[model samples]
Target: MTQDLFHPHRHESHPKIISRLKRANGHLAAVARMIEEGKPCLEVAQQLQAVESAVRNAKQALIHDHMDHCLEEGSLSQQRAELKAISRYL
Candidate 1:
């Protein structure tokens, strides 16, 4: 079987990532409502920007935590491969 990266504990940043994603989801729903209600374009765009930023930040945190937990502890080839794989998202 393949190894499990997470055992008894989860990555420390997971909680923050989940929180960010939840906020982003809420903002996205609000933006949809705002659209249907004829809100100003500028206000809608600003809220979209906030949602995008939250998602981006959460993704960054997850990647950083992965690097810390995997890259820092894996074998040389594994670390290089992992880093190369994750680099595409950046």
Candidate 2:
């Protein structure tokens, strides 16, 4: 499969991040199943919040690695583009 730029390669570079993400994936799948089964709204909302937090944490880790490695050494134009793309996260 062709990995896009946003693909989470950092997780492979650091297994801890991958493990965190794997746990989050299980949580996400469970939440989805709960929603499908008409679980309580409040419980679903809580699960959604947990998923959002997990995604943000994963994204932050990836961004930190990208900035420290790719963007830092890239040319000015590349850095500018990366900065613009990264801003979308915020």
Candidate 1 least-lDDT 10 residues: 1-10
Give residue 48's lDDT in candidate 1 (0 to 100): 94
Q: Provide TM-scores for the models.
A: 0.85, 0.71
Candidate 1 residues lying further than 4 Å off, grouped into runs, are 1-9
lDDT of 1 by residue, 6-87 (tens): 7544777788889889989998999999999999999999999999988998888888888777677658888888799897
lDDT, residue 67, model 1: 74
Residue 47 shift from truth in candidate 1, angstroms: 0.8
Q: lDDT, candidate 2, residue 84?
A: 85
Tens-place lDDT digits, model 2, residues 1-90 = 124788944434467677779989999999999999999999999999999899789778877766666666567987888878886885
Cα deviation of 87, candidate 2, in Å = 2.4
Q: Identify the candidate with maximal lDDT.
A: 1
